[model samples]
Target chain A: MKLTIPGEELMGHGNLSCQGCGGSLAMRYALKALGRDTIAVIPACCWSIIDGPFPYSCLKIPVFHTAFETAASAASGVSAAMKIKGKKTTVLAWAGDGGTFDIGIQALSGAAERGDNIIYICYDNEAYMNTGIQRSSATPYGAWTTTTPAKKFKSAPKKNMVEIMVAHKIPYTATACIAYPEDFIKKIKKAKGFQGTKYIQVLAPCPTGWRYDPAKTIELSKMAVESGIYPLYEVENGIYKISRKAKNKTVKEYIKMQGRFSHLTGEVIDEMQKNVDKEWELLIRKEEFYGHTKE
Target chain B: MKKVVTGNYAASYGAKVSRAEVVAAYPITPQTQIVEKIASFVANNEMDAEYIKVESEHSAMAACVGASAAGCRAYTATSAQGLALMHEMLHWAANARLPVVMANVNRAMGPPWTVWTDQNDSLSQRDTGWLQFYCENSQEVFDTTIQAYKICEKIGLPGMLVLDAFILSHTSEPVEIYDQDRIDKFLPKYNPRYKLEPSETHAFGGLTTPEWYYELRYKIQSAMDEGLKEIESVGKDFGKMFGRKYGLIEKYRCDDIDTLLVMSGSTASTGKEVIDRLRDNGERIGLARMRVFRPFPKQEMRKLAEDVNKIIVIDRNISFGNEGIFFSELKSALYNENTDIPVYGFIAGLGGRDITMKDIEGMIKKADGKPKDIIWWGLK
Candidate 1:
């Protein structure tokens, strides 16, 4: 827990990420935490293309690019093989929101239930950014994606993936954001110490998908946490603790920053704020209740 | 020891002797018993392997692909819907060049849902880059399941052994189970040149641009082309070790014959029995059992087509639009061979319907040099 970033870089500079790509930063920070003795399991996501073309890799470590929905299961298989080979190497399953929240959830659930020793990281950027910003289950309410145009923006709330992983009774589960690399890398290091299934959901803000300025990537991520939208928390073996709690900021401040949410009316913003406050209260209650066990 | 075991048990014993390191499978009709036996072996400490309990057939193939990529031997079994469910991963396993061996019991695909024998389940996966073998009986099922692993590993591809559902999977036959030491000599331990090694980093199955994508596909086709030689060489080596021999196509009394009936899977046995009586009745008829369907046995087809004037092709599965899958393949294979000997195509035994000796004779009788091009045999 030195809170010091590793000097050695695993990801090479100049790859296939867009300007201020939060997913690229997440992988950079994650590789620094996990080190060289790791194999990345990348399903069909932006990273699959972003990892560069054939015979030219972006990461220094080995990468296994599997099908769209096989990251968790393939990582489980890789982890099992590593254990059999008597090598203590990390098998990291890095996927996007579409691969994780929707298609790959079943395989992830199975691996979690079986207690497969692999670190499954979902760099959620809300929509399917790699596929031209299609609507995903991780897209927030009232956001405009290609699948959900401005006329009919997303009517559903983003999926609660941390809670879903926590329900699997996994040994480690955490939610981090790309803007906070110190906390993000620390949580990844902490997850690496465990012996069972570990899941970390990193909020990767895609400027292209969210219709935001590329320079405001870090600002929007910071606002997402400050407005009580994507809270920074970790649940270790049924013991939940909120790492960073938000200040009292209106939901309008978060929505107004993104053009995807520009079409939302004031009445819909008020309704979203109410729902956000309710979810935060539920999180606080659970954290305080589980905090008793930490004592 | 010659033990009377079902085809599913034979497949289990084959995997056991070949020392499959990982078995991840799901339960489907006709294929459930195959996994049940493998699970029992692992539970009783008889097999040293990881028996992963999967929720679906997709996960079954995914888990196998993972283990195989990690440089370990993996095995799984499935039928109709389960095979269809694993369709995407089947291509993944083959395209990744992982030598994963699978036993696919040939159950009919359906909206009516029949759990009987037909080739639709495995034949539909013909272009998946997996080498396919059609088995006639429980003994062949046991023998070929073991052979599939050795052939695939040498060629660096995936293989599936196909046997008729219920007919071969449920029916018991006296099969001589090979000993571990003997099998060990025939098939050595699998140690790949590269693996999911953490110490040495290498990219696997990652993004390939259009510049290199076609070459990767060409390499797979080359492996399959080399697979023909491996299957035959290994089959001969297997024959040298044991007494039985298997070729790409098993020709039965086709020399100096005026007519020859061609079929695959267990139906070939019925065709053989009918041909035997036809020969006794002074008729020059023969049977050609198409064992390997993936590579198409083109060289064998050319030789067989030249020997006979009329070719009767019996297909248990239909392709729905034009002709039978095997029928179409055979006609194309023999198209440029300069023989216009009418390749009579007959469809029978779909959705678990039995293909009797009478049905085999009917197919031969329909091939009497007339305009009966494609016949749907024994349909009410």
Candidate 2:
């Protein structure tokens, strides 16, 4: 089935994003899904720079570049203000992986638990791309960040942010990839249908941080989902649904494409693959059990 | 309506009457009651505002920034640790030029963990470009909160109304609640030239190169300069509308005085009583209650010290390794005036130590020695 991409674009040209920036494409698709009547509450992320410098913005909508840990709370305030003003403007909280899973987690969790009316989109680029590839909680195991060098690669697994959101019993939570614009856009539109906090963690690979060819950003995003390293799924209320089934591709095939994982020995790669498999198996079990159960 | 209420409730009523469109805050000691009162106002359908109970004080200030940027009047209340937590966002709010007013219950900063009245909390945030107003009473707290919104909105800057923790925050006083219609007339709807609206899409707080960052900051400094006038004018307007007038500083028996006592917050109120007692004993001492700290009130300080032979500052907060915060700032303000007047710096009542009338009189008597450095009064 051919996915009908929206023809009209809300994202303007001449953004400050790096070439082949998957995060930029993710934002472009997000804007298309959100339409023109939206406000973006961006935290300290690549997009904060990608949106361009002061007095200049790449999006047709208003953007509030907030502090690193305040995207959710700021977006909640924007949503509250919009409600007071009787305007139906969608407040989209856009943050990076570091802003989401680490520094911003408290505010994000508070927003979710309070059922703040905003769409919190954590564009998961793994490491802190804007700040020279520092290690973040969302950086997967066996990855080489500046803080977690090749000598001592990231030993911790990526945080399960969507699961945390689901635990808050929010209206919606999902995982999408930049390679799949249709799936990502669909999830954003679905989130717009819900009133409370809707969280979407989209896999946006960073070429600079991942030490991969800039041209392979999309391909790496696709590989991330296909290899079950980042699955495409949505959890509405308590119902879990896998939007796109993983192709069961080997993690080594996905890891070999990125230089950040090149130093990973076969043993470590196998261990990483085993962790992903265990996580995927648990997700599948959750879908089977909770998918049929009412929230 | 003449009803007795705590400083926290007065702040809630002030925010309520000023028609704050949004209130986002966290509960901290001494400041919890302010947000609690706001929550009660919202619950009872008395205030038409969105009360966002944020997780932390950082988020509280951030939400206010967002709400204000979104073309709504935003307000919040916090104390020492909470205000310290919000230090980063306080700069964010001011630099963004969002007219978000906050009520800070002046509590002492802690290492040994004490929640009591002091000016250190608010004074530490003095350089954040927020227009700081130190109130002496519950009435002033209420009036300043309203006037803060006006002054901040007019000058495109944020403002913080400060009242001493427990002394003013928890203590009940008979505050006159003005008619809502009159308040609406005084502080009209917050209609900013720019806002976070889609129709007038603009990026706020974006990454700026050195090319624009300097000018943006210069504009903030210039706004603070103009904020001095706005505070005075807005205070006058508030006075005209509701019989009680305010200014950058409130003078008590300063006329024909050879020596002036300078202080802020609750200590200023105690100083006034001391001034009256000293005058009865034929002492030529008076009190200059500093109501506004930001914009420094430099011109006021200069003029107030032009005729006085000596200036004495009793600070409820210390700057550590330096003199009292107010004393240091006041001395700097009077530096260029060529007054050569000796300003005595006395640090007292830190961590909520009681500053009785006797303590004020004693500090005043010590000023006669003309100490050149900081005097840690009542230090054990």
Candidate 3:
């Protein structure tokens, strides 16, 4: 394999993240791309604990652990403060799915709408993994979290966060998977080049939350993209482009590999497959629509 | 430069002259004009600062925490419901020990929905480890704001300068806006020992176990204990630079008095006038206006209480299911004193009801050296 990723490690070892924690790798790759002159504003997420206790941190860059709902807002503050000081430091708001899709959505929306100069990355683990495996709005349909037991799985579909960011007409919005480090790093680097709000949601599979083998974290992340459940794509300046084409794997294969979806019946899996297909079709149509227009 | 401006504008000028590097605020009734004036100043290039129009007061304070932690002077302003919304971040800013100063127009909280003056909005945040300053008028609003930054930065805590809604916020008064060079000399740049710098990286507010969490809280209390002395010295420093003096509590004609009237914010102004008229009639009364409420001037209260036979605290804010909030805190402050002074509790002028000089006189007569649950004045 060609060594395309940066060799200089910004994230040190001995992090407190669980074994095979995809969120951990996501932070590592992001810091490598953003370099050392970056300030990360993290909310109440697994990364908050992953950075170790107070007076000690795992990353080389400064990390500001903030309240659960104010990651984007705090990042805006950091950006504003640095801007006034004439410091060219990259402000990154690194949050989990719960902080992004649920409690943090308002602050994220406000930051995006204002076109604040900050890079926001949401490491999507599908649930609130830090507190426990509780279901968040990012949890896909038929997913079983602690809050959504076997008898009552999550009925709602996962929120389409990229489209929401695209709606804000920000400079850039992308979806990358942890299995593809090159693509994730590329998106973060490209986001740093832009001078406004840039959002990227990276699919990070959690073995503890998903009830899968710890060693299968990378495998599950790859399967999620190949199965068309989480297509790697980016929206730049109102134009959508799929970064990686799906490998034509079935959604059932992706679901059966994870214990969180083991109890789902064939009928529910089929419905979820149909939902994924429809979303992919809509994304393709959006690309085609923009391609045909002057915008 | 003596500029006739509203209390809200005085706050804007205060932040401007203090050279705040970043300002984040959300508009609420009685506070909207403060940010508006700040926006005008920024737009007109009068002040060089980043004004973040955050979506809510929670984010306003959150941005202030971020900006302040990032080693910049951060400021913000809000009102009643907005201040209540910022309750969580208030604790965050204080715990992180960020010297972020804010202006809160004291508006009454609502169910019937009002935009009226009351101290309940700021008094509710008494336990949040923030230095609270209640301004008596527009000049005090301007003067205290500059002094708040100096005091808070010295103590490594956040400070809130409050002025009553409409009475101070909307009312225009002559405020002397000091020269920028002199104000800058009084309050130097905010140079924090620890900040969120990329060159010097460290995790702030991360998870701390019980072994360190208890001690971290004790440190905050210790800083507040130091804050009392800082507020006094900073007030004197500000007075020496400018002609206006300040302290935790302002004493008016309390040298020789049989009774002392205690109040805060605009009510203190009323109490001062009422005291002058009563003293003219040889009533032997004085007034103690609570300027800084957090490091509650207990020592000052005890020293003054020894000379007076009675203490009357008129609170515009209620603790609900108890007597006036100030009344309760005042009694607690006097509890350790060996004096048997009858501290009277007066709950009046709630929800923006006008408390006239006559009302103050009536409360003074009603004290009567008697124990009362709550003397509800102007309650029809």
Candidate 4:
């Protein structure tokens, strides 16, 4: 069965996000998948500014702009309150990487553990783009972010947030990308079909933060997946299925498009490449193991 | 029906009668009974509400903020550290203009942790844009808590119904209970003008640019001003229905008095005794009880101290560098009123230290007919 993306537009044009902002497009696609019968709980992030100021919201759906680190708990509350009203409102916890992987993890974990009937989507642009591109836990190893200057670049690997969510034993968890809108929208629609906690971490690129050209946002997202830097996959009830397989592009091809990684030496690049290959193999073994068991 | 219940139980009953749709709370001493009673109410199916037994005080308030924003009558209760821990969400609930009513069983802040009653816990949260009401008794606790829903819902601002820790929270008193059906007529179901509904999509608590941020906060302040104006009138209607009044300030025999001694919470009843005894002894003294702490109750403070020669405030909370918090607040309220009454700030209770009628009398005696600094009353 072919899943068609909804033609309905919940996000309006001329919003505040920087040009070619992948996080902005992720929201547009997310709203399309969920449609208008939704309430969005947004924490402080790039999307906070992207959703225009008060009295001039860009989203057509009702939005609840929350504190810096309360998207999940707020969505949990919104959904709980809606249940009492007997309204079928899809509450969306839309946040950025900083709000998700760092400050918001506590609230997110609490909500997930409780198995709240809400969908929490973190449109990760890697660094803290809203606060001037500081290095976040989601920032890749050897990448140059504002806080992690070229001297002592981000040496930590990108946090495996999908594994974290899967460990919560949630009903659904997935990784999506802007380059794969159909797959992204399909996974979101699938999440909506589930009753308990659903988390989708989308790899959205920031043109300004990632030091890439405005036109290369989709290209970067595509390369990130093709290089196994960010593979698209879904984990449902302990079963894993690779949504998009890597095309075997080197990490060099992926990093060449962005200036954030331009400062890396050949030795450092090899170290990063080794880590990525190891990560990809681990991911494949899990998919093979879980996928085999399911079959 | 009437029942002998603790003030905490009274708060739990109040939420039930209000038909609160969502309640999220964590347990702390004194305040534990309030949440436990609420949990039992939900467990027994006495209340048709979502009782989210959250992991912590922070999540408890966060859940309530979500519930309230989603257009439900939300309620919670806490004391001291729990209240302090819930501080961030408290600001969010108020700023979002979600009418989330909370009952804070006032307790002393910790160092050498104690569960005794004091005002510092709530007083420290003065500027969170939440309306505050201190109950003088368990009966008032029940009535005022219900009134708090009406108060917050009317103005679209959050409010707290405060009662003393063990003195009221743990101690039982006879409280008149009104059935849900009867209470429903007085306080109808919350009809939100705007909510988290796709039926009428709108952005709430959005990121306002500085160009518009000031006005949005100004609107909150304007709502506060409107709340102050509407409180007494709402109390009148509540009294007409329930035979109990919830005013900004509960004054006891303050008319035509020379020396006015002011206090809040359960201490009002004890202070009133001291006032009566002093009056019988031919001393012109009266007790002024602070009911609503936020919105400042400036008009009432000015009126209470209008004819008095001296005003002595016995605060259970301190402001660190400044005088007693209530003393500072009341003093500021009378600053522009042009009243030359020598207002004295007396720090009487801190860290669960017992405050009694004799201690209040000592505060009155220590007032040296001068606008002096805060005197640490009863300090050895």
Q: How badly does each model clash, as a count of residue pairs?
A: 0, 0, 0, 0
True contacts kept of each: 0.57, 0.88, 0.81, 0.75
Instruction: Give the C-alpha lDDT of model 1.
Output: 0.89
DockQ of 4: 0.73
Between candidates 2 and 3, the lDDT winner: 3
Q: How high is the lDDT of residue A153 in model 1? A: 88
How many angstroms is residue B258 displaced in model 3 relative to the true structure, after the best TM-score fit?
Answer: 1.5
Error of 3 at B333 (Å): 1.0
lDDT of 4 by residue, A1-295 (tens): 7558888889998699899999999999999999988889998998888898777889999888888778888888888898887887899999999999999898899889988889999999999999999999999998899899988999888898889999999999999999999999999999999988999999999999999899988988999999988989999998988887756798999998899999998888888789888988888899999989988
Q: How close is each model in CA RMSD to the real structure?
A: 1.6, 1.3, 1.0, 1.7
| Candidate 4 residue runs with Cα over 4 Å from true position | A1-3, A292-295
Interface RMSD, candidates in the order listed: 1.3, 0.7, 0.7, 1.1
B112-231 per-residue lDDT for model 1 (tens digits): 868888898898999999999999988888899778999999989999999898888999889998888898998898999988876667778877779899999999999988988888
DockQ values per model? 0.68, 0.88, 0.87, 0.73
Tens digit per residue, CA lDDT, model 3, A191-274: 998999999999999999999999999998999999889999898888888887755888999989899999999899889889
Residue-level lDDT of model 2, residues A49-143, one tens digit each, is 98888779988999999999999999989999999999999999999999999999999998988999999998988989998999998988889
Instruction: Please report how far candidate 4 places residue B338 from its true position, in Å.
Output: 3.9
lDDT of 1 at B26: 89
| Best prediction by lDDT | 3
